[model samples]
Target: MKDFLPVLKILLRFVIVYIVLVLLYQFYLNEYENDVVDPFTRWVAQQVAFLQSIFGFPTVLVDSLKLHSILFQTEGRFTTRMVEGCNVISVVILFSAFVFAFYKGAKTFLYVLAGLVILHILNVLRIVMLNIIFIKYPQYERVGHDYIFPAIVYGGVVVLWLIWIQFFALKKTDKS
Candidate 1:
């Protein structure tokens, strides 16, 4: 029982935080009625479209009814859709839960804030990259979107977690 205490604490904290954040997310979703683009999703689509335009690709983001997404279309054809999940809130929740559970000091807040910003930028870039890839090679859509791209985003979260543990969490744990 004593040996399991540390693991138990981390698990409990993670579960509690996850539940709370998910509940809040549910409330947010409820505020936007059916067949509507929530602000976050719309923002992500806008960011992707902006990037595409910057890269010399004419893009338009439109609220999609049938798919419940902010679809990004290039060359007057649908390229990809920025749905709720593409906003990366779920990944941020997981990252936050882990870091908060093992937080050491004031730096914990800063680390989480910086991590979220980086994660958001990475997510936007990921979408843009996927859009270009899929448009150029339509056959690779499944492999890129489902496998390669997700690995990059989640892999970034893992890297941030490792950095936190090494620089902050582990040092504090050793001192205590």
Candidate 2:
């Protein structure tokens, strides 16, 4: 029984943190009108559009609230849309939960903060790349959206967790 206690504690922490963050996010979504895009998603879409525009695409961002997503248009032609899933909030919540579960010290919060920012920026780049793919090679949209981008985002989270465990969570070895 004693051996299982630590594992159980970590599990509980993970579950509790995950559930609380998800509930908070759901509440945030509920506070917004269904016809309007939620603020976080809107912010992510804006970042994606800005980056695309920087690439000379002249991207147009449209908050098609009725559709529950932000639309991207280039030169009056619709390119793609960014749904709530593209916002990376869910991933952020998950990453945070994991970090909180295996929390090491005061520095853990800083790691979490840095992870969130890194994931946010990576997601923006992913969306911008997806938009370009959708515009240029519509046929590969499925492969890119469903497989490639998800790998990039989730794989990044895994790497961050591994790094945290290796450096922050683990006590350093004696080096004489």
Candidate 3:
């Protein structure tokens, strides 16, 4: 019991931090939805228009969901809302904190950052491809949204986490 006290303290600290972050994110998301989501969504629609014009493709922005507006283009659609918790930045921050808490070094930090960037870019591309798919075959929208897209986005995150754990965390221990 005595030896476990330090470990318990660490776990408690992590829980407190995680809870605070979650609450803050929820508050921010609520405020953002009320104030900024629509305008930002309109801006995204404009960008889609410009991109469609440039690429010579048709794009549609749909308000099917509540949290964020979905943009549908010949290539793909993504949400325009830059809500802090909805996008990759939040993922990066959370994962970086977790990794840093466990690994504790500059190299680990950089790896996490790189992974986060990769995940974000992939997410953007995924949205584009899904939009294209949705436009080409409207019937597939349900399948794409419910299964394919979530798998791609969340699966990408999982892969990134594994890479970080294996190459960054485990590899160093193996070498030592």
Off by over 4 Å in 2: 173-176
Candidate 1 lDDT over 32-143, as tens digits, reads: 8685578887888888899999998889977777888887889879888888888999999899889988856688889999999999999999999999987898999999
Candidates' lDDT values, in order? 0.88, 0.88, 0.59
Q: Give the TM-scores of the predictions, in the order they appear.
A: 0.93, 0.94, 0.64
Q: Return the clash pairs for model 1, or none.
A: none
Candidate 1: segments with Cα more than 4 A from true spot: 172-176
Q: lDDT per residue, candidate 2, 5-68, as tens digits?
A: 9889889999999999999999998888675578788888888888888997888887786788
Model 2 clashes, total count? 0
Model 1 lDDT on a 0 to 1 scale: 0.88
How well is each residue in 66-113 modelled by candidate 3, as lDDT tens digits?
A: 545543534455423223233444555566555654464688758777
TM-score of 1: 0.93
